[model samples]
Target: MDRERVVEWLEGGSVSIPKVLLKHYADIGLNEIEFLTLLHIHESIGSGNPFPTPIEISNRMSIDGTACSEVLRSLMKRGFLAIEQQDVSMMICEKYSLRPLWQKLASLMFETVHEEEEQERERSETDLYTMFEKEFGRPLSPFECETLSMWIDQDDHEPVIIKAALREAVMSGKLNFRYIDRILFEWKKNGVKTIEQARNQSRKFRQHQQPKQGVSSNEGTRKTTIPFFNWLEQ
Candidate 1:
């Protein structure tokens, strides 16, 4: 190609396509011809002609008019294209709408995103099981796994809060799943939904108990001192 031709092509601007269309064209059951036909319609719309005739599309794409018509028919049958007649300059002309195409594309993209999110969540839940097994020094039984799943799926407890409760139970010499469940239950009952909240509650509980422990220790000391004095009097 000549430099001038290349410069002209470069200055002609670009066609914008949705990333979802590029990645999932085949997944959405669109053949190459059908995809190209859609692109031509999109370009026509950009060029201020919302509806381009089959001949116009074929001329631009180097395809025969008959083949372009077949593709358009197929796309229409698949609910991706629609035709409507409009009055243009007192003459009836067919106008094509690509709204169904956009709606189908949106649905496919949403399904793809939801599937990815579910897969990630499963992987995270698996990792939680692995962490629990390592901490407990044994593999979880079927019942234990069921319990964990219930917490994740039914109770809607976050993994971080559950892990925090587990750590608290372990530190208190109660390293069993039942004890951990009890801790989580109590926290949930008290509206502790986060790791930070659980930690704060634990700190407050310890602080509340410390004064009573101190008083008990002081009373024991007084009793011992009194016994020692009575022995001296004897």
Candidate 2:
């Protein structure tokens, strides 16, 4: 590799713009010419030239100065651009203000983040059924599907609560929907809304049953704490 070529390539400079702009340029009704113009303006601003002429912008784009000026005017009218006068060294100077564009871009960025989170949440919710089926080692029937949906929609149970209930059912050697539903019902009745609350309740319930339970092996019999919640008793 040639070092001078590398440095020269780096010296060609770069422009920084939000990823949201690339993904959602159409959302703001900006055509290729308009977007490219904005990029040039952004680059010029970054280079400390706040007031770049149409000729300067056009030199970097396919359009001429007249077309560039028209595009700039259009952007200003569309509420995506503004111009401001500022005192530089005791002399008033006109400069381009991209505050409106930045504001809109920021709004679009937030909207995209929210949209991505919603998509991820939906994916997790849909995966709950698959998790249950994998645990049970069988396909869920339509009635079972309806029951799960009822727990989520009608009962207003979050996925975490339902999953905790499922864990209880599995750990208790009672891998059935009824037992899971009973656990969830009891948790709801006792205000076990969060996963931590459910865990505390489970631990206390197991502790309460610890004294009365023992394990028998071929070697001997010994008293041991039950690790699973006895939801059947509740």
Candidate 3:
């Protein structure tokens, strides 16, 4: 090509596509030909033409006009492309918009994040089940499993707090769900939503029950002790 022609080509400008759209086109259900056709439409819009004929778009692509027209129809059916008729100076003008495609891509990204979070939650619950079985020295009964699920799904307790409660039950020699449930209930009622808060609350209760110094064994066989907080008593 001549220098002038090369200069003109270089100055003709280019289409700018969002990286997300390019990366996730197929994930949003756009095939190769459909995506290419969409890009040409985007380019034409940036070049001051919101509406380009299928034949004109196809001339720059490998597909024929009929195939390009079908692709456009498919996009319309899939809610990815739309043609709007606008009144411009007493003339009706057709314009193509890809707003739906962008909206779908945005929803797809949200769903991907939501799916990952759900997977992580499932993994955490599985680990909790394993921990419970390990502590109890046997597989959880159906009722125990159901109770565990209820604690999470209905009560909305954090897994870490529940694990802390399990440790508290073990330390207190209360190896039963009823005792653990009471511990979790007491912690939640006391605003101990975190493991650290729960531990702090337990420590404070123990400290508050500290016994005063009394006669030693050598003097009168007297003893002193800090009382343990019985969650079941409450």
**Each model's TM-score?**
0.76, 0.66, 0.81
Root-mean-square deviation of each candidate, in angstroms? 9.1, 5.3, 3.5
* Candidate 1, superposed: residue stretches over 4 Å from native: 1-13, 84-94, 211-234
The lDDT values for all models are 0.81, 0.87, 0.90
**Compared with the true structure, what per-residue lDDT tens digits does model 3 show for residues 46-151?**
8889999999999999999999999999999999999999888999999999888889999999999999999999988999999999999999999999999999
Can you write out model 2's per-residue Cα lDDT over 149-231, one digit (the tens) per residue?
Answer: 99989998988789888888878899999899999999898999999999898887877654556667875888756466667
Which stretch of 10 consecutive residues in model 2 shows the poorest summed lDDT?
Answer: 206-215
| Candidate 3 structure lDDT | 0.90
Instruction: Per model, state how many residue pairs clash.
Output: 0, 0, 0
Between candidates 1 and 3, name the one with more favorable TM-score.
3
Which candidate ranks first by lDDT, i.e. highest? 3
TM-score of 2: 0.66
Q: Per-residue error at 169 for model 2, in Å?
A: 1.1
* Candidate 2: residue 4 lDDT (0-100): 100
| Candidate no. 3 TM-score | 0.81
